[model samples]
Target: MSIREKIVKEYEFLKPEMIKTIGELITFPSVLDEEAVETPFGKNIDLCLDKALEKCKELGFKVFKDSKGYYGYAEIGTGEEMIAVLGHLDVVPAGDIAKWESDPFKMEQRDGKLYGRGTQDDKGPTVIALYAIKSIMNIGLKLNKRVRVIFGTDEENLWRCINRYMELEEKPSMGFTPDSKFPMIYAEKGLLQFNAIGKGESVVLSGGGAYNAVPDKFQYKSKDLKSLEEKLIANGTKYEIDGDTITVFGKSVHAAVGEEGINAIKMLMLALKETGVATPSLDFISDYVGNDPYAEKIFGVLEDEASGKLKFNLGKVEINSEKSLLGIDIRIPVTISKEEIVTKIKNIIKQYGFEYEERDFLRSLYVPLDHTLIKTLRKVYEEETEFDSTPLSSGGATYARSMENCVAFGAVFPDGKKTEHQPNENLAIRDMDRAFIIYAKAIYELAK
Candidate 1:
């Protein structure tokens, strides 16, 4: 039988197993955290590792858990050649369940789609890849290589899971991550997170967290909020008033793709200018919040890169007797230098005599399109689906960059909508079965 036929047949046998695995992963709220809290980031990660280890052992693949709790594998063959498949189980925090069609944690299947948080961003594709390995093994295919799938538990946070795994494992020859879109991805933009504080009148606000994530809610208090509202309206800005509490409506989006939407910080700045708190110029706040000269000279730059508009969120606000701290959050392009960006921001603050400090800085990551693994996967995508999709770039981050020779492959299709990190996230059931066959073929090709 043709490889495609064999793959489709194998996927039919693998459907039940795939569904059960995804359901279990979504049940755990594995968002990232630094502090060792009871339900901290990887609270149920060990449990996931246990499940993966059990299955890997059953599939005739040797499993290894690192000292730091990350897991690895050894799917043995000959010639000292190796192939890697990367995937993550940890998911982003589910926000505003009221916006969801169903529980974000519970896996729901409707109209050929499975709805849940990790169902698309990663867990779905990850399971498909594992079963791909199983299908290849079940067929007793002999090849000249070994394929190993690595499950990371902290990809949404610091990527410590894969970092720890590398400390105990050898790098693979080539690999693909089944987490992104199809046709394939050839380039991925870098990411950076920064904070800026100024010494204007202070406001009282709190409850924003995760620099890479959009804050669910935040509120600020200013003695002159009435004037603030007037200034905002005068400046062609938008906002909401609640008694003495001024709530600026900041658009929320995943940090990787934040540039595509309106930022909360800019709205607050406009509101401040309308109220005579700061200059209406983007530079006024950009100087305080951005890292380098880019903010100072961004007015013209906005026209060129406006397709990927940069943005910030006014996650939290607070006013006090000392000074109001505008908890401004920012996401910028990857090509910018971190120190230069910070220096420009510091310089802007010095001019206003406002003190500013950065709270978190996450580096951006990217890989080239000509990469062998990327080429191989792209070829597979074209051959299998007859779709000539090229490897594309994205603002979102993934565990693919955590290791070498890895590019994100698909559970998400191009015509497919982006529900990742958004409410009512889901994966089409037909897409799930199709992904299994694709993954199985990719694994067979990589393993051989």
Candidate 2:
């Protein structure tokens, strides 16, 4: 039998085990909760890592859980070179259960598709990677390198999970993360996180729950009902008017691919000034929103020519007497500096006499598109899918950036693939089987 056929046979044997594990993992709601002592993100993260470690032990591989709680491996090989298969266990919280045809956490097979939040994003790919390792082990493939599958915790928020992993272990020779679109990732844009704070007391505001996913539902409240209502309508914006609550409506869109949703908070804040509620801080926000004279000035400093995609999200907001707080999220292009962005926000806040603080600073992750790890994985995907798509850039950050010599792989296909981060997040059963086979081949080739 050919190498491909051998890998397929090994994958066929692991199908039942893979299905059960994936289903069990999909049952937990791994949403990031800052309120908990250990961090809600860490709790779900530990759960996924434990599950993975248990399975690896069952498959008779030497497993290691570091002091920081990240999962690691020591698969035997004779060479100094190491091959890594990086995949995250954490997933973005399912936005709304009402929008889903089925449960977001419960894995349901519909017309051959598996539907769940982490199914396509990372969990499904994680399972595929696991079985691929199993296939290589079962066949006793002799290779010159050590292959490790590192499971990370925080890909959605800050990536402390993978950072701790690197601190404990040696960097891999080459690796692939089945987190992005397939057929080789030639380039990924630089990712930068920005936190902007709104000053003083104000009302009529709203924002997003997660920085990555688009904000589906945004609500804003203001004490001055008449001005808020009038400005909303005058701007040709549709809004819901109740006794005292006025919520503006806009199409919610993925923050990275800002095609539809205009930020409701920005709209409401900009409206506050137009409706005669002007403060110095509002002027700063207006400029940042591309409304004032400083839009062009900020872009020159923030834009990256290599990636050529600049995206931003107005993530969160709170209205109070001391001040109205707004969380501004920015995905900086390749050329911007984290320090520069922070400095800009500080200057803007100082100009308005508002207090400025950086909540979370996420540095941009860049892997040259021409790297060998990406090119080899891309070749395998192209040969399998028979499609001619190029490696793509994403505004959101992943664990791939934390690990050296690593690039994102499958999980999300082309735009035509099933809805991800949407109400009915799911994966096809046939596709799950196919992914297992593909990952098996990828692991075998890389491990050998």
Candidate 3:
């Protein structure tokens, strides 16, 4: 059998072990937590890293975990050039426990799909990549270059872990991350997260916990609950009215694709405005933003051929007697400058008497489709899946943008289910099986 066939057989042989490893890793609930001495991100994250590195050692890869718990890596082979497969272990908070059919922390398989938090967003892909390394080793493939699987714990929030990893380690010759779509991601849009703060006393509003997810639940204090209820009912929004508080419920999705989720914060603001409890910030957002996925009202139609249009999400909103704050997430097209977007946003918010503060920003990444790394990955994807292996751009940010000569290869296929940052997040067993074959082949080709 050819080396590729041998690698596939090894992956099939290790399928059970791979599933078990993913299950074990998913049970850690490795969401970012209060920092401790040894566990900088949180105890759970540190524990997850320990477990991952332990598996790496068992697979005969030299393991290294940063003392600060920022990142970890496992490597095999002997060569001067190193290729990296980057992925993250941390997951976003499992919002609304009631929404999940099973425990988000407990991995459960039903009807050929593994369900849990981090199953698709990252943890599953990370494990699959490690096993790909194992498959190559199992086949006794002598690679001319070293292959390193770098595990990060902060891709869901800030990329601090990967940032620290770059500072401490040498840059890879070239790399890909199994954190996005299958054919390949050649371009990723720029990310800008900011907070718009203003003074408001008419209502107390607060919603959303993460900067990258659409706010699924929003609650505000209002004396006109009946009027708000009427408006909400008229608007056909899901909501609950409690004594003096109103809670609106909507779907949650990754901010990069925020159009898929109904913005509960926007709905709540509209209800408040209709009920005559208008705060300036609420009125401004309700009138200007109004649940549009693109910030077209404020920024105009910003688009580029490389990464498509600008995507926007009002991920968070807070209003109290003392002050009001609007947390915004924007994925800019690759062609636009950050200053151009930031200046326009600041000027618009200033019109409403709100102060705009940038919380975080990630510049766009674009590697030509004809690049050697892109060509190699695309070939692997086409040969493995027989799908149209066209390169694509993404609104979601990944570790691929964290370093030079890197792009996001996929654990998700072209027609695969997309559950990232959504309730009942899951990964299909069949999809993972295909990804293992693709990753194993890609690694061998890249490393060799």
The prediction achieving the highest lDDT against the true structure is 3
Order of models, best lDDT first: 3, 2, 1
Q: Name the regions of candidate 2 deviating beyond 4 angstroms.
A: 13-51, 72-74, 89-123, 138-140, 153-160, 184-251, 271-278, 292-294, 301-306, 315-321, 415-427
Candidate 1 Cα misplacement greater than 4 A, ranges: 9-44, 72-74, 78-81, 91-121, 138-145, 156-158, 166-168, 197-230, 239-336, 350-358, 386-388, 415-427, 446-448
Ranking by TM-score: 2, 1, 3
| Model 2 error, position 390 (Å) | 0.8
Alpha-carbon TM-score of each model against the true structure: 0.74, 0.76, 0.73
Write down the lDDT of every candidate, Cα atoms only: 0.65, 0.67, 0.88
In the range 16-76, model 2's lDDT, one tens digit per residue, is 8887888888887766666656543557767777777887788776788776564545354
lDDT of candidate 2 vs native?
A: 0.67
Q: Considering summed lDDT, which 10 consecutive residues are worst modelled in model 3?
A: 200-209
Clashes of each: 19, 8, 0
Q: Write the per-residue lDDT of candidate 1 for residues 1-448, one digit (tens) a residue.
A: 9877877787788779778878877886666655655532455766766676677787678777665565545464555888888888778889898998888888988887889888887777787788788888777778788777888877776777777777778888878788777866544444445445554444333545656655434455665677777766775555777777766655566655544444555566545544544331233554444422233353224211311434444445444445555454454554545565566656665665545666655454445566656666766777667566666656566566666667677878766877888998888887777677777777776667
Model 1, backbone clash pairs (residues 3+ apart or across chains), number: 19
Off by over 4 Å in 3: 26-29, 35-37, 91-121, 196-301, 311-327, 344-355, 415-427
Clashing pairs in 2: 112-429, 113-428, 114-427, 115-426, 177-409, 186-369, 200-323, 204-221
